[model samples]
Target: MRTPNASRAALTLAALFLATLSLAALPAGVQARSSDRGKPMLINADDADHALDESQPTVLSGNVVITQGTLDIRSARADVTTRNNEPTRVVLTGSPARLKQEMDDGSPFSANASRIVYDLTSDTVTLTGNVTVNQRGNTMNGPRVVYNMKTGRVQASGTGTGSGNGRVSMRIEPKNPTPADESGND
Candidate 1:
């Protein structure tokens, strides 16, 4: 389903993002003073609680959200761990969840889809499921995306053999999506 036009746009966006990653003003990786100080972590949901076992780390479930600093990870379930109780990382599980990271600078970045994983220690983020990453005005979308938070590196992909630059389609204007079939065609 790749079109020549969207392919072109994706390539252009990828190039711009690569160039921007070198600039310090972009947000996904910047660390403010508060980030090192360890801002409060917030979790919200319609229902939530934590469970831990001698066999497993603390797990929080049900529309879970965990946020600290400018990094926010959301999903149906999240396992929180502290390396020696110091909160080294959090792992989330859910279909098409999202992770949004805002930098100390004015720049911001976001990932959308299922199978998204973040490495808190390294500040690296991976998005699977038609992943899209946007920085400033540049954007790229594909089946998966890997963003290195500490390094501000981003890569998007559809397949191993697919073209590195692919066209992405969007509009400055928003429009409603087509309604699903009443019979249950999701």
Candidate 2:
């Protein structure tokens, strides 16, 4: 025998899951609006490899692409490390990486960098070495960027590249600056 409240809760949960699946099937822009409910998936090419350490078993080299909601990350070489079959970390390197995600307001963001590191347990991702992110026509040029997968939080910092004078540039779309504005002419 089930109480009325308990039965109602079960039905609500079921409805939520079904709705999630339905939304995930939509295009990327649609997914952005309903991104609160979606699953992260990974795809790997034949060249990808995984190594748990030198002495342990290792998968050879290949292309690996990881997708989460509206976010997509592609890399040439990837190594997946796991303990007890639970993925602890993933490293993507060699061919560099491109990360694309749709912003909440329907704008798109793209990040290009040398390497991308993801920690499953911590839900954190770090992009290193000449990392540049372009979003909503604004560009963030930094050596590194750390983003929390679950919380949508990002921190940008230099990867030991010191000049103290970091550069940040933002550009609004449909509007183009004149030659003098670009060249800093008098």
Candidate 3:
């Protein structure tokens, strides 16, 4: 009971629907952070609040957690900024935002601070306000600490009190310890 033109119209609609589905299935966001490129980032939170405009930042609150590759971040609240639909920066705040990841050498790295800023463009993470970082057996504590992911470099600074009142503190364990010979041979 259908004309040839009607059949053609139905076929066209079906093809259009399938094409739309395929496009919707494509992943959102461009590759902004090279280190995290090709790695899927997952975010979990009690609530996600964001602006209607996709270009604006998204805010996650209440037991927020973000994971990408080996990098893990947890905080009470976090704000994520994206450009071109890719996350460019993330700011986390809490009693103390916590971060953990594995170094290139398989050593464990961890940090905590009142505020943490992760810059995807420069591949750096800055921890501020009572910051502490522990990597392998080395530890650093200060008011501010900056870690460069690409260079494996860390910088910590205090208020320059110079009296250890708020100075940077560090503890580095020896790579190896040798025991003294019991024989006392010459």
Q: Pick the candidate with the highest lDDT.
A: 3
Off by over 4 Å in 2: 1-42, 48-60, 66-71, 103-106, 148-153, 159-186
Error of 3 at 119 (Å): 2.9
RMSD to the hidden true structure, all candidates: 15.2, 11.7, 15.3
Which residue pairs come into collision in candidate 1?
6-167, 6-168, 7-166, 7-167, 27-103, 82-87, 96-113, 96-114
Write the residue-wise lDDT of candidate 1 on 36-95 in tens digits: 125654555545333222234455568866555666656776554445334444455677
Q: lDDT for model 3, please.
A: 0.60
Ranking by lDDT: 3, 2, 1
> Estimated TM-score per prediction?
0.51, 0.53, 0.62
Global lDDT for candidate 1? 0.50
Task: List where candidate 3 sits over 4 angstroms from the true fold.
Answer: 1-41, 68-71, 102-106, 121-123, 148-153, 160-165, 180-186
| Residue 60, model 2: Cα distance from true site in angstroms | 6.6
Q: In candidate 3, how many Å is residue 54 off? A: 3.8
Model 3 residue 98 lDDT score: 76
**Candidate number with the higher TM-score (2 or 3):** 3
